[model samples]
Target: MAEPTISVIIPAYNAAAFIAEALLSVLNQTSPADEVIVVNDGSTDNTRQVAASFEPHFGGRLIIIDQANAGVAAARNAAYRRASGELVAMLDADDYYLPAFLATARRAFTLMPDIVLFFGDTEIVDANGPTGRLNSEGKPVRTLPAIEIDGLFKVRGSTFTTLLEGSYIPVCAAAVRRATALAVGLFDLSVRTSEDRDFFCRLALRGPMAFSREVMAHERIHGGNISISTHRVDLARNVLTVMRKLRRPEHACLMSDQERSALEAVYKDEFFNYVYNLSSAGWRAYVKGVAMLPADERLAALHPKHLARALAAAVGMSSND
Candidate 1:
């Protein structure tokens, strides 16, 4: 069996300052990418110039797809359409991969014929340096790696089940087979945010996924990070919406009854979290979220106290009352 060819697809938007580092990481990969595609989604900065500059260095291995101010999902879709490799390595403009990332993923695909996707842990950083490594719980800590192994990748337990619990798989740390990507239809553009979550959820339904313990990629955390800049309320709301759609009968049918029950439990957990986050914002968001809740699930999912708090927040009264 031959190792799969990999394409590193980066979607950049006003990422001039960081694009070079990302490109360099790809260039320095132990098992270098077979193709490098960067889609400049209408960046006003030098992102286009900086990314396009790599074409010559790649010696025609680089592809620059310039498009209007489309979102990251669309930009990735464009790059994927142009990618010819058997595996697509999803890299973010603000993040860079460890030298072993592609080599590790390719080796996994070559070894495990059933695995279609895999993600590794990410090292969280800031302007200073490394802060901590992201854990399975979507948190950061300066702890040791999740697992110690001489090998590049580790085939894990139920990827789908773990993913159903939370959205911990960072975009920068994952790679998927090109065929599997097409089968599920890459990214969902309708979502304003959490498109990565949507895409990953769909992929989880497809088949098995692997995990890399230590740090496989770098995730930069700054004030200007997308999760910070984007509207949190809207993003959180869309997250629930997307999750509901993803867990519908068509997709949820693949899961056993226990899995489906677990899926519903998480959905409710997310719903309450969403409402709690909006409690301070006032009634409009609360009303919207409640309205979005289905009639069947409302009585069980939405507590009276939650509604009372929303009403209380709308008025001058304290929420405790």
Candidate 2:
């Protein structure tokens, strides 16, 4: 069977220094992408020039879309709108795919015909150079039983629960069926941080997903990453928003009774964590956190002592209290 065409979407913002390496990575893919779409999201740098420079080299397969400074989510949505392929893959301007990345994703798709999303391990890169694999807490990326398709091996499973706990799949290391993406919709523009998590969570809810054991991409860790620049309170708020979205009645159809119960437990834990983080901010933030809590458990789990402490902090109480 002929391999399905894959379109790669890259949202770049003042990424002139690193965009070329990212484009090169796609160009060097063992199984070339059907098209490479680079959306220059109101870049102040020469990102447009750098991206356009590669169009001729790729025989016009490289497509560049220039949009006013809207934000990463908008930029990605723009590129996604123009993508024409069976599968849509994502890579950040500062990140690049390993040579075998596309091949591995295709293999996973072929073997797990029922799945819509595929992701693999990622190697973290920094100024010092290639560092190590991305992990959760201190645990390395988890392994699962393997299945072979054609000549490649991939593990099949549902990452919905894992994704709800925390995002382990980096955008650069994952691919989704174009149909699945359209069904799931675009990234949430309101979420400046953890937008990828929001997008992945929605996709995970839609259907099954799988993973490749091999490291298929590079995730660059730098000061420019949105997660690094966004305020902790705002980040926590966005996370809470995603958690709420997952628990909505419309999304509840995605999981069984047991899984839904498990998710509720997770949400309970996350609620406390959110409130604790906002406790020191002041009364307004603390109230906002409380307002964001799920109706089912709002204030039920919030101890009066914790509320008093939050109020005390809001009114200039010492940390000792």
Candidate 3:
């Protein structure tokens, strides 16, 4: 049999309510994936059942793996190992892709044979309604344009620094060459929130990435999402830890000074944001951010605005305490 052109990996927990839609989206793709692998990560709900129901529809095209609740990173890694496609794409169980996703990716890869990664714009939807399509910053970005190789780092200023700010590249909207994904190593299992950011940083350092202007997926923002709930503190902590690890590595030298300065600004913004955004025990979160900041002189480079914000937040917390 011919090798599949793309493998779509979906890591599902208790996503019964939305997994069906996610599966249907892949099955309906204009340039359908060669294989769809859904890993049911010890879901207590009917997630397995929902995945099983689609078995007949996908036939040999769908492969399901059941494992104990080992986290999304582990589930994705397992699926990646089982995939036989030349390219690997990921979609969260709660999200679904547009029909043109794979078709555009195929064309992009054909045109830019050297590019190792491809990602496009996404439509952000919530329980209330469709909010509209957005770029990585949650800003409305219309028009799809092919980005030049240097444009990725040039526009972003610093790739690593931009990553420290936040995840602009939504994992669900990304497709990567199989070899490139494997070479970069699978997503960091230790990071619960910023695994995609860590993976993207590593990949960007290795090769060029393609950003498609097309909106090819819908990212659902529900109450149950990790980003929406109170775990924002945990997310902040994990992202800081990942950033610290990246900075200490020899690869950190690959980034320009401008990128490094941008990263410092991101660290300060993240620290201040966590301090002000905490609904419960603001002092505790502030303490956590302070504890996470690097000890070196680099901390002195934090933006004055962020420093002021952090100070204001600290005073507010102290008064409440």
Best by lDDT: 2
**Candidate 3's residue-wise lDDT over 76-121, tens digit each?**
9999899998888899999999998887777667766667787877
Candidate 3 colliding pairs:
144-213
Q: How many residue pairs clash in each candidate?
A: 0, 0, 1
lDDT of 2 by residue, 1-321 (tens): 677789999999999999999999999999989999999898998999999989888997988888899998898888888999888899999999999999888877877667778887788888987987463324323644446565444444545666677777778988998888888787888877778877887887777777766788888988564543126667777777777778888778878786688688877777766666677677777777677666765665367756776788778895554
Off by over 4 Å in 2: 134-157, 224-230, 288-303, 315-321
The TM-score obtained by model 2 is: 0.88
Model 1 C-alpha lDDT per residue in residues 230-303, reported as the tens digit of each score: 26667767777776876778878777676677778878787776666565456776777667778875665467
Clashing residue pairs in candidate 2 are: none
lDDT of 3 at 29: 93
Per TM-score, the best of the predicted structures is 2
Q: How well does candidate 1 match the true structure in TM-score terms?
A: 0.86
All candidates: TM-score = 0.86, 0.88, 0.77
RMSD of 2: 3.0
